[model samples]
Target: MKHVTKADGGRQPFDPEKVQRTLRKMGVGAEDAERIAGEIAESVPDGVRTAAVLRMIRARAKAVHPAVSHRTNLRRALGLLRSKPDFEEFVRVLLREHGYQVETGCVLAGRCGEHEVDAVAEKDGTTVFVEVKHHVSHHRVTGLDEGRIARAIIEDLQEGFRSGRCVVAIDGALIVCNTKLSEHAKRYATCRGIGHIGWDYPEERNLRTMIEETQSYPITIVAGVSRSVSTRLAAAGVVTAKQIAYGDATTIAHDADIPLKEVLLIAGRARAILEA
Candidate 1:
């Protein structure tokens, strides 16, 4: 077995099983899967960076199929929203784009106490308290604690209703995360009618689908955009591709300290993705 350096710089023997599983999950056909597996086996060097391996997989997958590749890449970008504040803002932007009015870090006084909700989404006369659980480590799974958090939000909703803090009736509580939820947590949420939107949930309409439908790719997804560029873009209040697409490239270039030509290229790519 060849040793591969992981993202944390730890070295471990490569697992071929992981390649097959990921290929299947990415919706690659068996024939294509075998070909991709062969390519991976040939391309990966001993002590190759895990991030490089992921890039290779995505590149090879894209060569095999564009639609599936986009789906896989969407999942990757969604998982990268690891920072708590960034993830919360992402959810707010997503909901707002879907026509919901959103507010974040809202503090409301319940009859029992004051509750701080990560986000509040309202649409069509319905209001929901959204609790965001963001984990930097993609391997971590959200568990029973999520259900507990949802239940707590529900309690706050109940008390807020009594205190007139909530003029309208609370519709439901939602748990949104950039990671997977444990089976027990999923069961608990379902039993309580609590909504969930993890990185990959509701098989058909997960976070990937949500972003694709809205054409709201994160700034981090832009080709040739580095972490520093993305951070600068975010600091300038431009978090999504849609935001960049609609804004002036010259101003963005000056503000982000990126060359105007490169900014134009990025904007073009963003528009192309949206049109695609």
Candidate 2:
């Protein structure tokens, strides 16, 4: 196999088995996975991009199973959550779907001091205070600063727990980020019983799995759409692709001042993607 360049500019030998394995992980049957791998191997030339290969596999998988495409490409969709405020809103939606009532950017007084909580969540008699650490890109990894963040959060939780902010008592202090956590931080959180929800934490209930479960795909998932346009759409309060799909394109165009033709196309693509 020839070497292929990755999106991060690293080079590695192309492996069709990797494609098949990913497909299988997405619930594709063995025969179909092998067939898809064969097609990708034949289609991709030497020196092709790994990202391009992924896009090809996603496209082909979408033809067979829609969830496969959405699940596989979710990290890219989530990377579109460029701003801290937007990431918070995305978390709100996610929590809401998970049956948690959420409040964002609230200040709670602890026994030691006042702490600004990123989000406060309540579900089934449990109250959770969340501190969101959002990154603009996947290149950033949280919890890499020698457990400084984890230690600080644990300390905050201690004060909050002592203060008795919740009538039923505080359940846990959760740190949710749009990227991964460092091993040290993970260990720290685990030891302290702090909940860490990263892009791929909690195994089954990661951000990608949650998004797929709720079908709340973000606007960034639509291919061929520029980040500028998606950012503008998010600014206009259209954060999810499902919103664009179910909404009126004309109204969106008039409000956002985007051309009606382009708005329609974006909505069409979103509808097709979610429907497939």
Candidate 3:
């Protein structure tokens, strides 16, 4: 009916079509999404916060099935991860889903310095040195300064390869981040020939779109997936819900060294999230 307050305290005119699009992205049928968006637009007050609208939408999603809410609960789940180590692992798994062979925690010597890479990803014989920037806050943005740093890193890595200081052959550099990118960041990355993936940048190929399309949600998306459980699973290279949903339960259970029953419960929850 009026402007909706964003999480960052900015306001935007309430549009039911936008809500419907979000619902459809979350896998609500087109007819249902339209109906639900219409209902919210009519019922909500002028000053309602966007968070409140999402809560109302989530309630409706859960009415269809408890797991339906998980489809769009990615924001909260990703924010819960311990940013550095956990986020790096999550991105590694996401890259794997997109057909990249990823190696994490790689250290390479540059012409002037040594840089620690979040991942070295290869696909179709092309390799990239990936730098992962993770933000716990929903409102934080990946800015141009981050791009500047990444560009320098890429330049150094290129020099290292040319001079035979770095053993691995790298074709380019990429920045993988959990939040949206600033306009300057996008421009800089493009001008410098650096590949970038942000939450909603690059439109069709952004991180959020890729996650939904590949169904490569982090293991933490499951309810009650404690730090201990995730740590154990990560030790066995199980970082995504898709891995749990499709992997052999017995093997995963043994490899993670957690009980079979617990693994089944986790797998069951992962399956529910995917199939919701």
lDDT of 1 by residue, 74-178 (tens): 555655654656667778888888898887768766666777888788888878888888776765788888778678767776778877985545678878777
The candidate that wins on TM-score is 3
- How many backbone clashes are present in model 1? 0
Per-residue C-alpha lDDT of model 2 across residues 1-276, encoded as one tens digit per residue: 677897778889889899998776555778989999999988888989987888788788877876554342567667767766666777777788889889876776655666677788898887777777777677677874534554565466666766675232556777778788888788877887777788887788877678778878778777766777876776677778887889988888877778989888888878776776
| Global Cα lDDT for candidate 1 | 0.74
Query: Which 10-residue span in candidate 3 carries the lowest summed lDDT?
Result: 64-73
Each prediction's whole-model lDDT (CA)? 0.74, 0.75, 0.84
Q: Which regions of candidate 2 deviate over 4 angstroms?
A: 1-18, 21-32, 41-49, 55-72, 144-154, 157-169, 248-261
Best by lDDT: 3
Q: On a 0 to 1 TM-score scale, where does candidate 1 land against the true structure?
A: 0.72
User: Model 3: runs farther than 4 Å from truth?
Assistant: 69-72
Q: What is the lDDT, from 0 to 100, of the residue 56 in candidate 1?
A: 79
